[model samples]
Target: MGKLLENHSKNLLREAGVLVPKHVVARSPEEAAEKAAELGFPVVLKALVPVGKRGKAGAVKFAQNAQEAFELTRELLAMTVRHFPVEKVLIEEKIAIAQEWYLAITIDKKAQTPLIIASLKGGVDVEELSQSAPEQIMTKSIDPILGFAEFQAKELWSELGLTGKPLTLATQALTCLVKIFLAKDATLLEINPLVLTENGDVAAAASVMSVDDSAMYRHPELAAMVQLGSERTWRPLTDLEKRMVEVNELDPYRGTARYTEMDGGEIGFLCGGGGGSLLSFDALVSFGGRPANYSEVGGNPPERKVLGITKGILAKPGVKGLFVAHNITNNTQVDVLAQGVVQALKEMGKDPKIFPVVVREAGVNDEAAREIFTKTGVEYYGDNATITEAAQRMVERIKALEISGEGI
Candidate 1:
């Protein structure tokens, strides 16, 4: 799942014939004021970060005039919302509201079906809506094979007690939204306050969307909007994370290397084999070791790809030790993994012994990998040491290094 920023999702909605407020993205306060002036008075200024609950964080503000837009834009740009430094703000033409409603189309993962959730109770968070008045909210499941139909959309809004022009417009808007959701392979497409303007027109006042990354290959148009692997971080990708993305993309067909930074840790985690990495992380945490980052490198990556990821793993601040382990390989070559790790350590001028580097990889070419690791003065283990045992050894090595304060 990859979340699309508000501006991006709104633009997609507009393109699909769903009404949305006229908006522009401003990178600075001056730009915001200019855009506000161009869009007319009474504007909304929102911090353009990837996380939700911006209103709760005071990241969403209203500006009655150009001067207010300038001040609010400055305030928003200066704040960090949910760890993401605000670099841009969304300026929109504020609508005069008659009523606020809610509509969202998403995949029902549990039932493997498409789900539509709508509520007449709007201007409130969906969670709050569900909690406060569950009856006011309507939940409908669409058959994957049959799909959502025009009549189905109309019936949903009508059943919710919407009638006259609002009912017809809501039906059309939701139908379009559902089309957009399915067309884009979106995991979620939600309009928080599907507003009924004073003019009796429905507008998607807000949109929060996430698309399936596995289906991204089909959406070349969305490439620039979505940063792959964004689900791992609710906010923007850090510089290190970006580089790891590049390394992973370097040979898209061969292997995968995913990196995510964590707060306040010392051990540099380097592991792979998907499920194996999770277990490795658990083992490390179980042994009271704090890993600075989580990384998975696997699928028979070449030495350079492996080396690139290794360099990134060790580059995080406070990474005083390194722990590398993986499941017994099916196809990934241990010799290649060893070569890459050794090459990275050598290039980074790291002495494995004092720096606390540990590896517990096994399978095809294990003999070669073991020889290379030993020759490089790096602690080595094959299937002989369970992944858990390897993590224990890594913890002890880091402790020993802390006590000695000398390179091996």
Candidate 2:
């Protein structure tokens, strides 16, 4: 998923009719100091990195004068927190906070539903507060189809014990936040410390984070803000990622592939559909095997797309073993996936015998897929094999090959 920085997040909020502070982005310390002077004293300077815990990492600072602003700007610009180098800073007018709270709308992948999390306690770690005082956090799940109605937001405000204009302001903010979350196709939209001023006005004072990688196509402006440095390096995408992103945008009804690279042992996975992936991951971990990547080729993906996905897994480095496992209830063909795997290996100039591939396809077309794998010289397993069994088999195969000093 794509992570938006403070500036990009603020733009989305402002577009949704949420009241955010007047702010300017400065590339240099001099520019930041000048912007702070223009905005007046007691300004907040935040490093423009697409990561959370900036405040805890000392990436966020306050300046009461132009001199302090300049100093803070220089320090932040040169600082590297969590491996993300700060190149720009946001200078915003400091709002006088009367109260603080949390508000967020996100899709619960397990529940397959939209969820809203809120708290009366603001301007602090919600997790920390929840651990120390569990009663403060309020959470609700919303139907994706029905969404958050106005009454639902109002009821949330009432439950928080907010009164008068502040309640109205909060209700309005909640409604707008929901709209923004839906409109942007966001996976997560969080506003930590949604502040209420003494003047009875609501403002998003701090910690505005959003993850909306899916909506990048519709919002070119937001896509442009995705930083091209270490932020991308962590889960480095290959040429396939760029292609799949384009394919995702073109196909309205196609399944999505969430591909992220990881370092470790062999045995690349193509699992998931109704928590099977999670189970497989845990089983792999239990077997002392580190996955090469977390790649999910979702339900009913076309044979060609499956081929592309297999190619992606093969392209990954240190992936000397392959595990293609899916649940029995899933309606994907075994032959389609096996064909993809064989084609990818051939195109990459790798032999299945040398690479040690394992296929465990169940559900529809399982027999045909098993036959295909057998003919292609790839190891095949049946639906009766447990997750741990499949993982152990793949890991053992890799270990066998490694000990034999085989070249692939």
User: Best-fitting candidate, measured by TM-score?
Assistant: 1
The sequence of per-residue lDDT tens digits that candidate 1 reaches over residues 1-408 is 678899999999999999999999999989999999999989999998877778999999999888999999999989998888899999999999999998888878799888999999887888987888899999899887788898998899999999999999999999899888889999888898999999989999988898986566689899899845556666667888888877877766787777888887889998988889999999999998999999888789999999999999888877888888988888899999999999998888788766778899988899999999989888999988899999999988877777887533
Q: Residues 1-408, candidate 2, lDDT per residue (tens digit)? A: 677778888877888889998899999889988889999889999998877778899988999999999999999999887767788899999988888888878788799887888988877887798899888888888887888898899998889798888888899999998888787777777888799887779988764555556556687766676642222354324565665555444443566555666666577788867488877877777877778877777666666677777777777777887887877736666677677777777888777777877766687788888888888788888878876688788888888887899855
TM-score of each: 0.86, 0.85
RMSD of 2: 3.5
Which 10 successive residues of model 2 have the least lDDT summed? Answer: 227-236
Runs in model 1 lying further than 4 Å from the true structure: 107-114, 140-147, 212-218, 227-230, 273-275, 298-303, 328-336, 351-355, 362-377
Instruction: Choose the strongest candidate by lDDT.
Output: 1
What's every prediction's RMSD, in angstroms?
Answer: 3.1, 3.5
TM-score of 1: 0.86
Checking candidate 1 for backbone clashes, the offending pairs are none
Which lDDT value does model 2 have at 161? 92
